[model samples]
Target: MHVVIVGAGEVGRAIAANLESSHDVVVIDQDGDIVDELTYSLDVLAIEGDGTEIATLQEAGVEEAGLVIACTDDDETNVVVCGAAKTKSDVFTIARVRRRTLLETWEGSQGAFGVDFMVCTDLLTAQTIFRISGLPSAQDVDMFAGGLVRMAEFEITSESPVAGLSVQEADRYDSLTFAGIFRDDEMVVAKGDSVMQAGDRVVVIGSPDSVSGFGDDIVTRTSNGLEEVVIVGASEIGFQAAREFEEHGYRPRLIEQDHDRAREVAEALPNTIVMESDATDTEFLAREHVDEADIVIAALDGDEKNLLVSLLAKRLGVDRTVAIIENLEYAELFETVGIDVAVNPREETAEEIVRFTRADYTEKVAMLEHDRAEVIEIEIGEDSALQGGTIAEATADLPEGVVIGAISRGGDLVTPRGTTVIEPGDHVVVFVDANVLDEVIEAI
Candidate 1:
């Protein structure tokens, strides 16, 4: 596949970096310096020109390209680029529109002006913040299928009732399972015998109703204390996150570097504590008892600063540390830096766009990150070759590092074992590591 990317900004760079490995990538930006910088560093073909211009897009081979991604910071520019691409060529276009108003609803045209998709970064980041703070006790919430199914991460406190329960005992709850347990710096997918101790961070996956039920159980079993949240950097993205947290009754202490910027943020929300200071400084964080905060969202401007703040927060004993990483290239490195979650607004926004633009033949092709891996969802068609076979039999000749994580049959979800059969119409979620995506798909 050939991919033409507009804008050389952070989001454009992220999309290029993500597709460069698997697709023939061409990146266009108005700035010559940015074009030159990316041309030398990335594998993408860099073009210095306006993407809205038909000639510039033609020079980048938009006519031959399969996917044209407009990721400029300006929503109008993105729309223009998408319009030009869709008007001139048959390429699938994804326009990045940060403002929620620009996105409107999904019921609109699919390609009125070549925009097959639209991504709203602000909405994506804000929704992520809302989910986390909505469940104060839970460390974080990972939503799947438009919040139809939810995955919640919670830290087991000393007073929690599940402190001494084994994995099997916890799974006794009708619609819940101990998905994964993070303890002592290692992640363990739970088994029947696995135990939940005081310091363990447990992840549970279920429906929204089930999640609420689970939350109720946690509140009764554990002490219901106020969860303090401090967000470093009051960027629009930061403010968006703070807004969600604030709405959920978690008072967010927003730390901004510039005084005027802090004042601007203060005008928006009266509840948020907008403090003017450098969040990267450990001394400032320490003085505020940042470690005592239940959760800290370190969403600063720079990737390095966010990483440093997240690591510091973790070192200071913050329960969960989420870092807003601007550069998708440094996403995996966040885990190494001790950040619990790395939020990439552009890529996440792009995902919504990509999902909207996905072709009929493709089951599910997710852009996991700039590098590393992707989670591809596969559904066994009625006429498919491996329609009624077990996962072991279906993937017998499959390539390496391909794992079938879960299988959804009708409305029921199951973790496939050796004997677990995958019938026709079962939605199978497969995690395909970077090296063997093509081979794994071919085998299936």
Candidate 2:
């Protein structure tokens, strides 16, 4: 597949990095320095020119490309790029728009602009924060197919009522899949007979309604209950994080270096406590009760600041610490530094844009940290090896490290047990780590 990406900023770079492996990608940006930098790092064609210009699009082979993505920071530019690309050819086009009105009006149908997909990063990011915060006890919310499926991460604290029960016994309320469990530094693909233990980080996937039921029960009985969260930084990402945490029943404390900017954030978040303090200041963090906070979110624009704040929070005994890293170059350092999760906002935005531009047959493609691997959902063909075989037998030929979470058939979702058989036309959701995606695809 040939893809032409307009805008070579963080979002554009991310898209190129993800698609360069499987598709021929051309990136156009106005900055020559950025173009040269991207060309060296990513194996994609980089053109230094205005993406909205027809000449630039033509030079990038937009007419012959499989898709054209206009991901410039400006919404109008993105819309114009999409409109221009569609005017030239019948290629798939996706535009990144930040205006809420465009999305709200688009609820009825795709407008005459012929944009196949539109991504409102702020809106989606806001939605992510909102959904995560809604379930106060949920550590994270992973949505699939525009909220059709939801996966949540929750910690089983020492005081949890579900501490001693096996996964099969704990799932008495509804059908569930214990996708993975994180303990110490290891992540284990869970089995039905696996017993739940204290301090285990569990990833559960199921219908939205059932997932919420489990989260409520865990929140009510767990001592690791989150009451306060601290956000370090005053970027838009930080504001979104604070808003989401606040919605989840947590009182988030904001630490911003600038006093006036802190006041602005405080105005937007009436319930949150905003303070003017340097995030790198260890003394200030201690004085602000950062140690007692349930979670610490480092959204500082600078990578060094994010790293410092995360380390400080971790040292202060903040149980879970997440940092928003704009640069993919530093992703590897997070694991060694003990950060729980690093939120790649621009990368996420790029993934969403790519999904929007791709053909309808492509279900999902998720990129893991740095350049390690991708997790994708591929529909089962009529004659695929996955059909008409039990989970164990079906996966026997599949490569190792490919974990099948569930199979969606007709309208019913099944957590694949050893005896569970996958028939023709089933939509199997598999998690493939970075090393084995190709082998897993071959097996399927």
Candidate 3:
């Protein structure tokens, strides 16, 4: 299938990088330098033109594209591009937007922009921050099989009891499985004999309770008395994070640099306390007693401000810090520099939008380990080839790297074993590694 992508920004480049391996990808950008860079780096066609122009779409062969994704930095340009593409082709269209209002408008009005789907980076970023905040120990958290199952990554602290233990010894928690370990910038498969070293980032999959329990054991922190949550920005991402934490019953004190914006956020988020102050001011943060915060979120528009505020929050004795960073390069640096979790809106949205490009169109697909792996959720069909077979028989011919994380049938969740039978309508959640995703789906 041919895929045409507009805007050769970070998100567009990421999508092309992932899709160009299996599908023909054509990226459009006005900047000749970006186009030339993508052309030399990725195996995809790069065109220099305005994506919203009909001539540009034609030049990119939009009519022959199976999917057209408009992911420019400007939301209006993206919508217009997708809408214009509809005039030339019947291709499935997706538009990436930073504003949540556009998402609500198009969703409520039944696709007013001729967009088949809309991906909101702010909303995705907010959700990512909230997910990580709840599981303070995990560097990243993603859910599957409704809310029953979860996959989380955590850094093993030197004080962790299981830091030096083998995989078999660390597998003491029920319903939880250690998936992989990242040490010294390389990924190691988590076999029985694999020894978990300190500073290693470990991936775990299981029920939410089990994953949370395991997280608590690895990273030491007390969430009991630290009821205050300090938010270092009043940006859309920060506002959304405040609202989400409020829903989960957390007291969020939102600090905004703009006075009017603070008032607006305060009115909208009645459950939160909005204060006007400079997030980068250590004196101001000290006045707010940021040291008592259970979690501090750095969500300012500038990456430098977010990084500075997060470091200040930690210096003030905050238990955990989550930073919303736009630059993918800075994301890894944040974690390495002691930020609890780093959320990248562009990367999160890219991971989300990449799922729709898959051939099978599973119920959900999550990008893991910088798109090196995927956790896919697919519903079993009544006439499917896997319906009547046992788990062992069905997966016997499949590769060893794919692991069935969980199964859902009749609204009930099951941690499957070899004896477990595959039934029609069962939702199977599998963690796939490397390039075996296509083969795994084929076998199923």
Candidate 3: regions farther than 4 A off: 381-396, 418-424
Error of 1 at 278 (Å): 6.4
Higher-scoring candidate on TM-score, 1 or 3: 3
* Candidate 3 residue-wise lDDT, 1-444, digit = tens: 989999988999999998887888999999999988998999999999999999999999999999999999999999999899999989999999999999999989976898999999898888888888777577778888788778888888889988899988888877877777778657676778999988888888888889988888887777753477888888999998898889889878999989899989999998999999887778887777888788899989889989998888888888999888888899878988899788889989898888777636588888876777777888988765567888778777777677677888877777777788989889888777757776777666
Ranking by TM-score: 3, 2, 1
lDDT of 2 by residue, 95-200 (tens): 8776656766655576546677777775666555445544544646665544545677777866777887888788775556667666665656677787888867
* Index of the highest-lDDT prediction: 3
Better of 1 and 2 by TM-score: 2
For residue 422, model 2's alpha carbon misses the true position, in angstroms, by 1.2
Give the lDDT ranking, best first: 3, 2, 1
Q: List ranges where model 1 is wrong by over 4 Å.
A: 8-10, 13-25, 29-48, 63-66, 86-92, 99-114, 128-142, 145-226, 246-251, 256-291, 303-317, 327-339, 347-370, 442-444
Candidates' C-alpha lDDT? 0.72, 0.73, 0.85
Per-residue lDDT of candidate 1, residues 1-444 (tens digit) = 888888878777766765577679899999999989998899989999989999999999988988888888888888888888877787877888877656774326545455777777987887766666556456556655333455666767677777888877766565554556667555555667888887676766666676666765654422244477788998778888887777767678999998888999899977899889987678888898988887788878888888888888888888677888777768768865556667778767766555554444445555433324555566777765455777668767665555565567776666566577878777765656556766665555
Task: Return the top candidate by TM-score.
Answer: 3
**Of 1 and 2, the candidate ranking higher by lDDT:** 2
Poorly placed runs, candidate 2 (over 4 Å): 8-10, 21-24, 30-45, 72-80, 97-116, 122-141, 145-222, 257-259, 276-288, 357-359, 378-381, 397-401, 409-413, 433-444
Q: Model 2 TM-score?
A: 0.72
